[model samples]
Target: MAIDVGIIQDVETLLKNLNGYELLSYAICNEECGAETYEWLAGRVEGILVDEFRYLAKEKRKHAAELRKLFEELYPGMKPLEFNAPPLDTLPVCRELMKTKELENALAIAMLSETIGRDIYRKLQRMSGDEEVAELFKRLAEMKEAAYEKLLKLYEAMEK
Candidate 1:
């Protein structure tokens, strides 16, 4: 598919406008959505894939918790944002992959989502003026890259 430069620019503008708390809240929501998606997948897939999904689910939740902690520290008494709706636009793509109940589809979605996430985090890191927030975003981008590589490896293995 062709890259949507317009959409990318729109998202960049949105990210640039977000304050520290808003950025952290957005990250937390994305992590929670990811955790929920993986947990749902874990219940559907069997054998080794189930275990892998469960691990991914756990890691996603951990990411959410870490982001929440940071948000709390930054905004002492404020409540963290709730995951009441789809966090990111790609979340529906994940839901579609889950509905398909196909390992290949799930793996493909994971790879795509991770790449998008990494890019977003990199952009956020660069746009952030706060050193701590920038560092956190950089770390998140690195983690997303690692996850993307893992998903790509799994997808390739399944193709063979």
Candidate 2:
């Protein structure tokens, strides 16, 4: 459950340097990609894990919607950036772990992804010039942290 401080700091620095529009675009793309990933994972997992994966997928979609709403409100006529395909390297390992029914490995991958996402949102929240946008990022970061914590707990229980 412990994320590397160096990675977090690096990501934070990168996010903080973005302008408001760039930050919003980044958030939209990140949320959409996360939603797609979780949905795909849900279909691939089996048994009791299926329900949990589905729930996470639903949550990710909701996160995307929330970000979209905020983006629209902030920049009324501006179109949000479309989600680019995530890196090919990104979820294949998790898919392999799931295929082998390696629950702990799959959950570890998910937890790490969520931790990085949380740190990005946390940085955005701190550096955002607009109060409302900053608040939204704070909430988004909290959601990511909650998801990571849930996965970590499940991983620990599985290990036991």
Candidate 3:
């Protein structure tokens, strides 16, 4: 129930220090996880909500592909550092959302996850020294923002 500001700060610090390859590696993993989560949610929901979740899953996969292409371009011939442990799975909210049967709760948690992602991309954009990398992050953040808006609309419509 209680959120630890300290852990959040520590994670931010860790992300800030990561090299381009490392950051992208984590990002790729995150996108893959998001797609999988969305697909899982789609299976649990009914009616139009299923389509919305599938759409989100497809978008996530697209983002992952774009990130992977960028990663390959930036670090030609070098493999992205393998992410042994994905931090997204460890997030309390993500864990809780996975177990939740309530559609409203799932939607809220998904929106929150997207918000966190957008914020992270914005932060990375600000911190990156490379112009190309920064621009890519900015674009990714914008895309995430769009996805968040769609999720917000869905949430509002469900509430009506």
Candidate 4:
């Protein structure tokens, strides 16, 4: 379950500086990118992996939509900050895993990404000043944890 230490450090450093709003904005972008990446992978892969990727793609979109809705409710007329996404690529362990043709590697990457996301959401929850925002992040972190559990089971089955 080892991912690249450098990538993890870079992601952690980048996330450390973001405030609650910025973290939410980046999370929206991250979810969108994750959906896109999973969709791309679905087309490239086959069998059970295809279904899993497609499911993950859908889940990512749902997460992005939820985040967007929260942003609207919390920030009102303020727009989300525009910037290049820094999740999957900047934390390039997933990108490197993407290069591997093995379907099992896909599950590994997905599991690892969910783990990273859970940590990010937990940090955001801790940083939130508003009760609602903190609750939202807590729920999101739980969702990520659930996703990781599902992926872990899938990975173990794939390994067998």
Provide the TM-score for each candidate, comma-separated. 0.83, 0.78, 0.87, 0.86
Pick by TM-score: 2 or 4, better one: 4
lDDT of 1 by residue, 35-121 (tens): 887787778776667887788778888888888888888899998655465445354354466466677776777677778878888
Query: Model 3, range 33-93, lDDT digits (tens) per residue?
Result: 7788789889987776788889988988998899889988999998777665544523536
Better of 2 and 3 by lDDT: 3
Model 1, global lDDT: 0.76
10 residues in a row with least lDDT, candidate 3: 83-92
Model 1 scores worst on lDDT over the 10 consecutive residues at: 86-95
Name model 1 segments beyond 4 Å from true: 1-12
lDDT of predicted model 4: 0.79
Q: Is candidate 1 or candidate 4 better by lDDT?
A: 4
lDDT of 4 by residue, 33-131 (tens): 878887987887778988888998898899889989999998999988865854543265655555768778777777777887888788778877778
Highest TM-score scorer: 3
Rate residue 8 of model 2 by lDDT. 45
lDDT of 1 at 3: 36
Q: Candidates ranked by lDDT, best first? A: 4, 3, 1, 2
| CA error at residue 77 for candidate 4, angstroms | 1.2
Model 3's TM-score against the true structure: 0.87
